[model samples]
Target chain A: MNAIDHPLVTAYLDAVARETAELPAERRAELLADLREHVEASDARDDDQVREVLTGLGEPRTVAASALSEETPAGHIHPAPVAPGRAKLTVILLGCSGPLLLASSVVGTIALIAGLALLWGAPRWETRHKVIGTATAVAVPVLVFVGALLGAASRIGPIELLLLLAFSLGVPAVGATVLLRAVRR
Target chain B: MNEAGGRVPSQLRKGLLEYCVLALLRDEPKYGVELVAELSAVSVMTTSQGTIYPLLSRLRREGLVDTELRDSPSGPPRRYYTLTAVGLASLTEFARAWPLFRDAVDHFLTDPQGDPA
Candidate 1:
């Protein structure tokens, strides 16, 4: 029917497709065809009118909501309504408290190790391990910040936050292990 | 005396949506737009294409009706909805029960003192 010739109709269809690509192809085609018919039937014959109709249909998210199955898909669970808000709050809290927590814990651990080593007249290995562990512990947050920076710049998905959390916590624990090993020897 | 009666009886026409839709589609396949238009014409069932489309999709998902895309001469492709065998069986069940249900309610509202049994 040469339906795609009309620029406005074509644009609207493209928008619908972009918003609804996750849907089954058959369902997506059905919705697009119905919208196409509506646009064609309306007497208002310009881009502005077409846009008005699409706007009245509401946001692409709302339109997509109508087609989504009730069942949650695997891997990409639709978060509960409060989940995004909660996630944002948690991220902010973590961002603020994370470095302080790491720094304090690292300093405390190093102080304790140094105190013990000094009391025992320990070898250079003890001093070196304490310094390295303290530095590594402090570096963990910086590594996390760098990872977060990359995530923000690249527009990575939420999974990146999990990666950041793991790095932020894992590095310090590894440092603590090195110190404990030196103390044991 | 009032020329017209009081409010229309709710019992006479209430909750017939599923029955009405199935009945309409029993004869032949119809698409979203056509079904909405027909239902709106018959009763005070005013609905938008958006509303009808979802209901149709749900009906299809529930195995009540089957849908297929066909090229439309006038515009883009059309989604034609045909009653499935399960849908027809359900329709028959609804048809048999609807009249009895309607009459039972009608008797209570229209003839309060006529039958106590």
Candidate 2:
């Protein structure tokens, strides 16, 4: 190893790189570069000074966490670890809206809207997932409302309608699955 | 570390931390090690000095600061960060507001029970 590549410093930096795998590649590179510059500049005369420099740098995980939070957009103000509970609740609410709409439109609308609110608010999933989730979850109600207004549903049998509801449920179900899988936790 | 994965770093006024960083560059350009050292010297800021890199990176991205790579007399070339026109304006604005903001916080802290009216 080069003289500046102190064993302890290398280990710390390696850990930080591993923890920051989720950061945008450009950001991760910039961060690592900045850290490397600092380590090189410290130029500790001995192991003890090296230790003090590393201690001042703190744990790798903390450095990664702080780095991650800084990248989160201005309004996000994310709390600590992502909540699995929130992700689960969001899935259930959005995924069930189609089935519930068949039983009661008012209840179904409430669930879909609430689910959408949570979906948009949660940071676990990206904006793309949120848009897809919203689209799929709302598709059933929208189709139903539009079909009714246009008299398209008048020609369909009960079994066909049930199939339509199931189809609607299926799309949002897939959407919810994608979101659950995407949870940053 | 106290609670397995808990982050227990002291919460200094978050905005103040970045502004303090910007303030450091107002007079003259400073390198990464120099800036980090200045912050670490203050116990009240109380954080792992490494975390300040992200803030520095952000300050650069936001056009508040600009960096120049210069050859150091010692080892590797050092990246020196200098405040920009925008940065100076922002620091001045914060300096103006901070006294009032500080006094308000002090007032509440000192007179917690006396001003229930």
Candidate 3:
């Protein structure tokens, strides 16, 4: 049946579709079919009556929320919870170490190449993997630029940077593993 | 409305909602709007699409009811809800237990000293 002919049902489906865009297409079609059946059975004699009925069904978001709450599938990703202390630490670290890591890598690579070139005393030192290595070599400097911007915004210092590095990598790798294991039981 | 003594608070009647809907749909498939009107006639607990839609979804998931979509002559497509075999069994079970539960509650409230005697 054409949904456009029945505006009430169409509207309902449209709302559902908008809310469930992330859902598989087949599953979404099934939901629409179910809702269409509901409209057909109702004694809404006219379009106005049907619209009124749908209006009472609450907003699409609420409908989606209720549906989601009732039937979430296994292995769905829940948003990671960021505690106040940890969030603050993350912001500080991302800001400071991000830039430092980027800058040091770029400067270190350039220094190494310049030292080699001096030893060879050649006007040009071209390696077979120079293009790939150059690309890789620039990665840290870019990171440093982005990290410096973040750090400046967060007002993080060198000392905070070190602490952030320790926490950011250490917490997720070691602390999280231990904490998750404990919670699983 | 006044068959009993006073207005029945919705909270007290909430327990019977699923039973009522299931019973109403047992005879014929009814859509959202019609179901609301049917339920509103018996009790003050008015049914809205918001309330009924979720209940219908849950009932379908639980295998109590099934739905079908059909074209309407003048308006949007209609969804018809029919009681499944499981739904029929559930309704029968509810009918059997409802009276006993109702009576127990009635007696407790009416008994002066909380004694059924």
Candidate 4:
């Protein structure tokens, strides 16, 4: 039979139809059609399946609530344009901060400061990654500066200057790469 | 399992249930009952059969699913839901991400004593 002869099934479908009245006309019609078909398909003679189906479908209000919230199949809403742009900007700033450090300290300092601020402000990155990224970005260059001054005082070779450059540049570069991967994940 | 009557599973399912529907349709088109039965097989996923309909409706609106009314063997015509290409792509994406997400959560849960930072 196309329609459920059972009073319980009829009443349940009626409740769902009434509760979901606020849904768009097409959606409401589709929902009722679907529910009605489910009732008709089940072995109506078996009381247990009837109860199980009804219980599984839950109350009409709860069912409506689930659909009302805008969850996409990917399990998240489309992120705001600003958020994605900000996240991209943060990663770019982090990556660029290191190479800029090789330039004049003033420009390098500005990039580093702006990068650090953006990294911290970004919602995409985990706090742990941000903290580690910021700390390495600051500490690696400062430590290299202090070590270079000490080596200069001791009259070291040009090799020492290159070594200083490598350490200063490499740490933040690696840190930023790792952070980009982590945040994107 | 809502045996505990906790609201947490319901809340968690809110995020996951739509993907579950898409994954169900990934194999073949199914009617509402078949879809609900498959999803309800996992008790944590749903408490009510009726709830999936609204989700199906939303998926239709989002252009992830399309429905067609076909004559059933037993009764009045039945509305069968088919996954759009968009739906298939979304499911594929979710399938890729879920394992990595599960592993990440597992790592955090299993190694609670690891680096606090």
- Compute DockQ for each candidate against the true complex: 0.12, 0.54, 0.26, 0.43
Q: Which ten residues in a row have the lowest lDDT in candidate 4 chain A?
A: A73-82
Residue A64 of model 1, lDDT score: 62
lDDT of 1 by residue, B24-87 (tens): 8999998766776676675344322343454566577768899888888765677788999999
* Candidate 3 backbone clash number: 17
Off by over 4 Å in 4: A1-3, A46-52, A70-185, B115-117
Ranking by TM-score: 2, 4, 3, 1
Model 1 misplacement above 4 A: A1-36, A39-185, B1-14, B47-49
TM-score winner, 3 or 4: 4
Better of 1 and 3 by TM-score: 3
Q: Choose the strongest candidate by DockQ.
A: 2
Question: What RMSD value applies to candidate 2?
Answer: 10.2
**All models: lDDT?**
0.58, 0.82, 0.57, 0.74
Better of 2 and 4 by TM-score: 2
User: Candidate 2 lDDT, tens digit per residue, B22-72?
Assistant: 899988999988998898787656367788998888788889999999999
Sorted on DockQ, best first, the list reads 2, 4, 3, 1
Query: Which stretches of candidate 3 lie above 4 Å from their native place?
Result: A1-55, A59-65, A72-185, B1-14, B40-43, B112-114
Q: Write the per-residue lDDT of candidate 1 for residues A3-95, one digit (tens) a residue.
A: 335676677568667877777678787677666665555545566776665554445554565556322323555323323333233223333
Residues A1-185, candidate 4, lDDT per residue (tens digit)?
32376667788878777776656577667677777777777766666667776765677677665555533445665532225566666656666665576666777778788888988776667778888888778865577477677766377669876776787677777777877677566
